[model samples]
Target chain A: MTVVATDETGRATPVVSGYGPSFAEQQPPRNERRSPRRLPRGLRIALGAILPLLLLAAWQVATAFVPAYRLPSPASVVLAGVDLAQRGLLGVHVGISVQRVLLGFAIGAAVGLVLGALIGLSRWADVLLSPTISAFRAVPSLAWVPLIVLYIGLQENGKVAIIAIGALFPVFTTVAGALRHVDRHLVEAGRAFGLRGVSLLAQVQLPAVVPAVVSGLRLALAQSWLFLVAAELLGSSMGLGFLLTDSQYNGRLDRLFLTIILLAVFGKATDAVLGVGERALLKRWT
Target chain B: MTSTTALPVSFRGVGRAFGTARVLRDVDLDVAAGEIVAILGPSGCGKSTLLRSVSGLDAPSEGAVSIAGTAVGPVDQRCAVAFQEPRLLPWRSVEANVALGLPHGTAKEPGRRRVAELLELTGLADAARRRPREISGGMAQRASLARALAREPGVLVLDEPFGALDALTRLRMQDLLLDVHAAVPTTVILVTHDVDEALVLADHVVLLGTDGDLPGATVRRVVRVPGARPRDRGAPELVDLRAELLAGLGVPAHHTAPSTAQLSHQETA
Candidate 1:
């Protein structure tokens, strides 16, 4: 039978000769094609800045009409930040919170990954462990603070334990779910090729879920910050959370706003670092 | 690479069941060393189940499958399978995916050399560095075949390896499989639905279907195709066999010439 070739214009041309058009000849220059056009980086950044800039302007306008003790001006919040920095308290609070988050996140995520893999790969492990873990996950984050303090006794470990509890569930849930749903066909293929146990987990199952693991870690990081605030606000003497409570008690609204801003900035900064790693991982894995 | 002898495969009253439903039953067949055999059947006829039994990916509820005189174990190492979906690891480059099939404990250098050679054999050398998602379906299927060959398996199991490709690419892949068999001369057990594919490739084409009211499929008929490797697709003998195979598969042979129609009727009877 004669082959019919369709040109770009949608007209069919009959081919009477040898082989039909080669795959290379039929394919568009896909490598040279770029994704849909996007705004330039500088313009995109400027566009993103518009709302925050408008909020700052609105805040400045509000300070003129409202009482300074209630709603601090942006300049006064900056000045309060400077006051803390001058006294060396700002660095200590920020440093302490960051250290807590990083340590708790590392320990929690590592445990989550191990437990998640176990539950995911084994039916017996999942049956035995999942019910209890799910029930624990249902408990509110603040509910753990009292227990943590009672057990670990209001020390660095208590705060870290609280944060660790916050961080564990997201990583555990995502990793278990992702591993459970990893392509059965791929796993079967790997098995047919002589892979089993640890080799199968490393070579096939784990790599398949790298994207899920990264997203889970990002969620856990956010949870760590939330739990850190809960821990510090309840019992800690020095942290961003402590600064927030101390400022409110002393009628230092400016310092409270400064602490809130620092938390937002640091939370976003850590997430952004994770985002960079995610991009690299997706490039390599996906 | 030195010429490695292919292993013989034997099945004795093999059967498989998932819960209460039986998919295959009471089948017996023997494949000589270095021979090519095709299992052709209708959809849901347990063709893949039979092939999986050879690779030890699935065990028969009754009877046994032995390779080279040994009963097959779970995840048999002597056989390699190329499934219908290519099944290349999407995260890995084509070259790395092929290397994954190397026998366990193969030294790094020798494994690399074997993968490179199979890549060349499958005409995937150029796309070796590309991820499976970056390549076309046909190219990905070639990578799958290359990975299977990298095992240097005693029996190469292909479960509809080209069934997903377009018609033109399928025809090309058929020829490529022939070339691969010629190069390695390893025992190949190919499962496919296409009558032409089986006729063009296998030394013996085993037709699998239910016998009257049997609950599960077994070997219905074994048609030994009469031709050498790379047989002409449109040859009169192949066309006649194709009509007969289709008739056995329950398709009407009314469109064929009168004499072939009579032949198919008699064969089905």
Candidate 2:
């Protein structure tokens, strides 16, 4: 039963397992990784890391012996990727492409959410908007490329328009579908609790739709990247897509492989971030 | 009834019908403040619909529903409902789902306390952090109870709340509900097809029978239960009453007798 004096000479309480500042913020000790000598987690991670390394090694071995036109060796392509990244030219193109994708994604997502929610919320809105949206969506993202290029010129607007178009429909369709399935019972429950109109929508329906919307966003993110490459090929000065196209003119297969690998990794990274968010959200309700 | 200012719930001339079928006809029921009333009925009877009307999930086609004399058209925050299925958000932790039922304006610290209190009250204190999928059906229902009680409603409406539990669990829930009701003194309107449950929990018992023409309909008969508080589940009088209700429900007088207290399997199966 001893008290300790701190810097200000104020009395300090003794720390005990369940009786200290830590006690105030107590949580169950997390289950230990539980491998006196190690098991599932280490094995899983090792397996994950090893597969990619093995693939790269195999690809490099094949490329070293194979002719240059078809496939570049893994080491050379990685080196080329590093060289492109360091040159500042690759960064400029990557930066502009990223900016266009993000800006377009934001705009498309915003518009999609509003329209999707509106249609999802009401039969009248659904009736008015569904057919037109379906028709527009049926026309592929690439088909809009020519039209947008003609109207806005194949530059910033065209690339952005392409990404926006690519990102929009998935989000829109997902939101609409999610809205449709967003638990009729919960909405009625909200209304019963004196929540009406917009309050009901905001409080119950919107949160319910989030997981589905997140799924759509994940799809849209992947699609926008694919569409970005296609748009860049038409008339963008720089981008991962532009890099690929420009490399093809001189048949620099190494740079093409590098950009393609970057796209795959970048798309996977977006999916990973999305997976994190989805897990977090699912954790909230379940 | 209007003169009884203390009464928290009052139903007047409440009649409901769909197309040509009548569910409730000129129904009049009143729940005194802190009183618990159980609505007992047969299958296809509108016991659920009646409870839904009280919950504002379904509006009575005739007459009106009022809370402290305020006519209710839609569900209000003043009452909380627990369904048979534990219709939870499925994405929220037990605690967060419980917290969601809280009225928006409540301050955080006290609201958190209330959520904790409800969790503890429902015997779900340890499972608050668990997800619905991670818990047993009993625990999920317990969380559902916590969610309903978190609102601190003037009226607590339950529709076969324990009709899904195992026999032992259902008995435990019945007792738990009785204890909680004693503590909170909120007007509880429990709808069930279990006459034993109605007798044990209700200060007043309402017997409901089906209307022949109505495919999805019901009508209720109010039966006042008189005896000491916490009526014994094993008592002879309760057994007789339950049997009478069964007869009223069109079960043959000599049918297989069920322990009405263990009513969970009866209704669901």
Candidate 3:
């Protein structure tokens, strides 16, 4: 056990693998392989549609048990939708609401990305700004209506600002948190490959935070819709929110029910689209 | 077209501590150009810290480490490392992951060719577009090695690069590593707890330990592996050497004496 040897007598012999050589040339399996348990396209579509049809049946049955004026039947709601569409009001209101949400969301997400990067990358920015933003975040989005109207009047700018404000916090919190806690080994790998400063941040840190940031965007998108309703009720004359308020005020229960269903459908549709896009973007990582 | 001038790595009175717990203390070792040195020690012996110091991932608290006579910083571009975890970017394809190892400002054509060369060498050319989660552990590790080699470093540091693989995969990776080293000669410092791995791959083995009542881990013994790179796995000398290494790591070998018979039985598994 105590025998100490040196290279003086340990003559070098060229090392060769005991496995000899590649007996046959090996090839890696193709990258086009799909998941083994995938269901057929038609079956998948059928499976996805079953629950919604059941929910629609339940809604129709519930209308039979409730008062007609309070809870409109699905048939009556559809008739009201047809009436509004015949008058060309449905398209105008829905289009206006959709535009506001998209514009507000774009602005909010851009601001959040910049602010989150600053806070996440620099200690000084986090210490100086995070506390104040957190305090403001605690206030409900509706609470700012009076102040907003007072300063800016009941206009498109004020409504869009409300939606932006509602959407901002989630994106900011997630991006900063994700960047701060990225895997240490990944960072080390980046450094080993000679990445530093801005290149490291752009190539490694940003990509690592993408999954979390996207989830945050989804949450912000849903919040924007909620805020849009409140903002429109406070000030606007044309939007899905306006139709809901107008119908409720005039006791037009069928129109009210139609507007509510339309909002729900729009929200669900947008969420589904976002989910699909996210899956496509992160197919490799997930 | 990177130079293959094998860099000599030297540590002089090197020490490292986290707050107050000193891990490595007053260590001194030199690995010659193109030689493979394995750092072997028990769980708390700071073998990984020693490797990290050389790669500049972790700075030494005292003394200095130099490669080719140049002192290293916290991020040394002259050396590359492969870790126990493959640590591939989940967002990147295998080919892109390998390409990431190219130094900044490297022209596009050369980098692309180097990545393709590495993928071919590592047997990953066909799985080039596959993502990390889509591959097996062995494939991921092979990609990691390719990424490290894409840097064309003068020194390669591997911190238990095959520690996570199954036994069969580990054996294959060892053979693959030998083939890689032969094809592109570079100084290698491999850290491992397995005595067999150290003996099989290294030209010299450095056993780190706390000499009774010592404050931190230091080089307790430096054993020059007898024979060449592809030494017979069941050689009598290697069997004795394995037992010696186990004893050096404080494993009691009472029931199993170092012999050719024991080596064969161990290898069969």
Candidate 4:
């Protein structure tokens, strides 16, 4: 009887195609071969672009029915961006937003990692800190703004504090949860080999949670962007969020559309960069 | 590499209890320097707990375990263990994972050289750069063994290291283990359920079992197998010993011939 093997894609191929004892002699030596069903990279990317292009077309069509003051055409939005670029105001706004996001995300994520590790590794720390942290997390991001502005007085530091608060919880939650679930067998093995405390965490526990850590970082970054807008809208002299409010008050619908588009592009661009790093980390780890 | 000075390990009235449940009771055994001892027992007999005590991974509640006349500490530096599963770090390559077993504070150059030597000895030279997930089960186990040896440990603890491999691979691994022991000459404590494996590799086979109505298992028998390294598996003496061991384990003897009286009576009928 011939034996059959089914690959992950639900395709069955006979492992030994013929039913005789000499089937092994008849078969060629097995070697690495790529699956025929996979689409090419270029084709996959093109497939992904199709939906966005369709949405753009739909938006362009909708502009003809709506008044320009209410809903600017895509071409007019592009013109508004060109106008801002020529005046150099667009660069200043975009740069400031990017800077704020990076700074706040860095500080928040670093603190979150340390605190999360402490809470996850030590039962005493968990018992002491978890309740207070949960109460803080329950307060909304916007709720921090009034208190932050009162203390820091609408400066860059106040805006940064808001963004940092936004970025903190995701990293803290994921890192702590992930650490608790690292394979017990692996930890025991490491301990058996003379690993203890910090060395054990570095060699085994931390590396085992790379995938979760990366995902946490990604979530933290997205939150940074969200809180950046909140902080900027409240009290920024220059930023994409400021541009958003300024355009709305000035009734420049075209520039308002431009700001929204820029936000989308920048957010996706940052996430993509993180995605590349995540892939590299997961390759080395899991 | 210079030959490691194997340290003697001793257990005095060792017993273990988890909460109210006892697992081992009054277990006493002494391992000579550079000797191989196999602990064979049924499931739940605390064979693993006994080995873990030697490595200082688990402490016996009632008694002490000592290495070289010094009581074992919370995390004994004198011992290294290869568990039933490979338990290799998936993130690390085989070479790096093996390097992790090197004793703390080893110099960089020496550590690298030691890792290389173990990779070669374990027949993992080509797969040194490969991650744990890339290698086969037997290869992973060899890497685990190599990792344990990289410590140059006084006592190497193996808890069913070859139990997960196929029969052919298991035989090959047993031989590889012999080779490793010949090179390092460290004290080894092996826990296994396979009777044949115990007879093949150990100088002394220790059987652990519960006595009468005892709550916990203890040392039931210790048989010193005759002959030196690489003894004949099918020798008459070994075969007879195998039968006796099987009988002691409550296994009935197989393939015995009918008596002459029964055969003659059947023919007359």
Query: Who wins the lDDT comparison?
Result: 1
Clashing pairs in 2: A192-B75, A192-B76, A284-B91, A284-B92, A285-B91, A285-B92, A286-B91, A286-B92, A286-B131
Candidate 3 local lDDT, B1-269, one digit each (tens): 56566799999999999988989999999999999999998887899999999999889999999998999877787889999888898889999999998867889998998898888778788778988766677777889999998888889999999887766567667777887887899999999988888888899999888776667899877889998776666667887888876777777555365343222111100
Q: What's model 1's lDDT at B178?
A: 78
Give every collision pair in model 3. none
Which lDDT tens digits does candidate 2 get at residues B91-167? 66788878877877878888888888777777677777776665666666777787887777888989899887766
Off by over 4 Å in 3: A1-68, B255-269
Q: Chain A TM-score for each candidate, in the given order? A: 0.88, 0.82, 0.82, 0.86
Kindly indicate the candidate among 2 and 3 with the higher lDDT.
Answer: 3
Query: By DockQ, is 3 or 4 better?
Result: 3
What is the lDDT, from 0 to 100, of the residue A277 in candidate 2?
94
Instruction: Name the fnat for model 3.
Output: 0.29
- lDDT at A37 for candidate 1? 80
Give, for candidate 4 chain B, the lowest lDDT window spanning 10 residues: B260-269
Clashing pairs in 1: none
lDDT of 1 by residue, A134-240 (tens): 99889886797887788898789988888887888899999999999999999999999999999999999999999999999999999999998988998778999
> Distance (Å) between predicted and true CA of B157, model 4?
0.5
The 10-residue segment with the lowest total lDDT in model 1 chain B? B260-269
Point to the candidate with the largest TM-score. 1
Candidate 3, residues A1-286, lDDT tens digits: the string is 3222222111121112322232112222323346668889999999999998998899899988999888888899899999999999999999999999988888888888888888888899989998988888788767888898899876999888888887887888888888888898898888878888898898789999888888889988998999899889986899999998899899999999888889999998888888887877777454
lDDT values for all models: 0.85, 0.74, 0.82, 0.83
For each candidate, what TM-score against the reference? Answer: 0.92, 0.81, 0.89, 0.87
